[model samples]
Target: MTAESALTPTPAANAAGLPLALDAVGGDHGAVPNVDGAVQAARAGVRVMLVGDRVKLHAELSKYPGAAGLPLEVVDAPDVIGMDEHASDVRGRKDASINVAARLVKDGQAAALISMGHSGATMAASLLILGRLPGIDRPAILTHIPAKTGTVALLDAGANADVKATYLAQWARLASTYLKVVEARENPTVGLLSIGEEDHKGNAVTLEAHALLRQQAGINFYGNVEGGDLFKGTTDIVVTDGFTGNIVLKLAEGEARVLFGWIREALGSSARSKLGGLLVRGGLRTVAEKMDPGTYGASILLGVRGLSYIGHGSADARAVKNALLRAARAHQSRLIERLSTELSGPS
Candidate 1:
């Protein structure tokens, strides 16, 4: 179809009321992984709309057996926006894959959109196309980080650089709802990122957020939590601005890498070390595999009118499949509509 039709912002809810739009063109590994994920999601009984080059997607579809006659449909667009293109530049490039995915949600063709492409473009396209749910100042990206204790929903991972105490409170609400829908938790503990657990700790913004989150009756605020508390899963949801959340996310990932390297070095140090490594290799591999970010697939861009998942640029087919499953789960759980109401309350 034409670019104007592709960019149209339709409501996400369908007549039957499913909530997911499987973005077939999103991902760093090109259309193979994306199409594979779509096929997998369709097999899993998820409703998906593929938005990308029809020729390439159909060719990929032919490679997979039993993928025929699925509920998936391809909306063709002649152009595609690249991952390197700045988010700001995507609006001018209407045929960008993310834009087409967002349009599916916007025009009532799908309930939500899932993408593994550039996060900036996803957020920008969602905002520019689907617009924000009422009362949400900005759309926040939520990552379901697999922590030491359990998974925690970290918000504003890269949506808004600047934030406010009120926004933090809103994040708490949105994240609480997210955990509830995804993890089936009624009251997930909400933690404000801080230097210490004390009330007086942290910078001006965090301190203010601490007070606001505490006062937010809608959220299950658990008071201040330090950066170290992240992997400990001290809280079910961690609320912070994009700046801090992104940095913390990267650091956590980096530390995981460093530890893996150290283990490798230590395991091969000598014969004695090799023997010791053999003893613990299974357990170590289990932890390493579980802790890998690729295992989680992609992060969800929450607080928008629809589902917009941002996958890692380096994501492989497995990661793509995981993201599609996430999109399906989010749609089944009515995550976006639920989050909108939780964040905005009654009109």
Candidate 2:
């Protein structure tokens, strides 16, 4: 089929709904992991639409047994936006894999989108294609971050570099609703990221947001929380400007990697240490799994008209599979529609 027809609107899906659009190219490792995730999602009963190079994607899918005859379809989209390219650089490449994925959602042929490509390109394609839901000024890159206890849901992970107090209040509203409704966490606490727990200790933007979030109804707003509060699971939902949220996310990921590396080195440093490690292998593995980024899949780009997920460029097959499952769950929960409703309601 031609590129244009491959992307054309198709008949509406059954009541079960359209398949998820998995962008199968432009990842750091290539299309295999993306297709692998698609296969897993299909096996788990989530219909998938693989969007990428026809020949390469099909070749990868053929390598996996039982991939054929599953509720999965492929849309030939050969164009790709490299990780190094700027977001706007994708604007001209309408046939790019990510752009096709977004278009599938736009054309009602896909229920959601999952990709580990250039994040900026993901956001740009999503905005340019699906656009934002009504009443949402900007889309926040939100992720469900696993912690020692319960998970912490953070918003504006890296979407808007510049935002206002009002934007943060919106993030609180959407995040709290998601945690309560989707995650089954009743009355999820909303914490404003700041230097100190005191409300007055933040900068002008955060100070203003503190008041705004406090006034917002339907959310259990906590006072300002510091960086330490994030992993402590001190609050269920943490709201911050994109700049700070991005920093917190990257730093935490880096620290976790370093900390785990240190542990591995110390465990193998001596024979006695190795013996202890063997004894606690199961316990250590349990802890490691919880800390692993793949456990949570990718971050959800909330406030968009449709469900959109963005994973790390270097995500492996496991991460991609988890990301697909997460996106399917988001679609089943009607997260995008619920977020829109909440935003339209009272502050």
Candidate 3:
């Protein structure tokens, strides 16, 4: 496709009705969670095309007798990309599940691509197959963080480990647009993740990005935010390099697990504590549900010509189901078309 044509917004009527293409053989547990998730989503009326080894997929589907009545199709993808494989391997692994899934989106047979595979390979497939959106030099990954009041959008989560100031500025715009178009948050505020709240407190790159963001139109720049600010609900969106953002994401995940483990240990320490735990079990369950990463499902690879989402490598059936549902919702919302318009405007 020509550059101009690739940049043009795809009409919702043509792509919105397509089925979601899922990499059924690409997660930590292979087709188990993927098939279950596909069954769950299909049961909910979302059409899903599972791309992977046809035999394995069929065998898994057979485990769920009710799945036969659901809208689920399996496409043959005999190869599976390993988690340790480099993203470049996608070019050689012609029939890899993720590659096939991406191709389905590019060919208009799928509205979006969802994979719980090697995230690097998934991102590569999206970039190589679907191409980048207009005005986007490098696409970024966007993940939602549960905050004090609501969820916060964090971008460049792991897509670009090393980035230029311009990339950071662009990600802020992308994240803002995503929040507005998909999350229904109008004029969302942005925060530059840094060591301190002051504009001058960040490194040279952040300092430069801060100036550019200040001059950028349409977004509500909220200056700089510290690491703690993420859970404080300090801003609607947060922008950082993938290196730092990935570290922050990992740290947060680890901390949450440790904290919950401690809570469980403390609750079971004695009969008195056990009674207290039971009393607050309902409230704790609500909090836990909100804090669960699976609740958010997948991180969107924004700035792609087509919609792409990357879920956790260790994703469960619930997470996969949520990811498929989220992808369907995003396609129905005309997210890619809206994003094209957002990026095609003034820098």
Write the residue-wise lDDT of candidate 1 on 16-124 in tens digits: 3553565566656778888876776566565567788889888988998877766677778666767787778777978777777788788977777777777788888
Better of 1 and 2 by lDDT: 2
Per-residue lDDT tens digits for candidate 3, residues 60-165, read: 9999987877778999999989988888999999799999999999998899999999999999999999999888889999998889867789988989989999
Q: Rank the candidates by lDDT, best first.
A: 3, 2, 1
Candidate 1, which segments miss by more than 4 Å at Cα? 1-20, 275-279, 344-347
Model 2 ranges off by over 4 Å: 1-15
Largest lDDT belongs to which candidate? 3
Give me the overall lDDT of model 2. Answer: 0.83
Which pairs of residues have clashing backbones in candidate 3? none
Whose lDDT is higher: candidate 1's or candidate 3's? 3
Name model 3 segments beyond 4 Å from true: 1-16
RMSD from true fold, candidate 2: 6.1
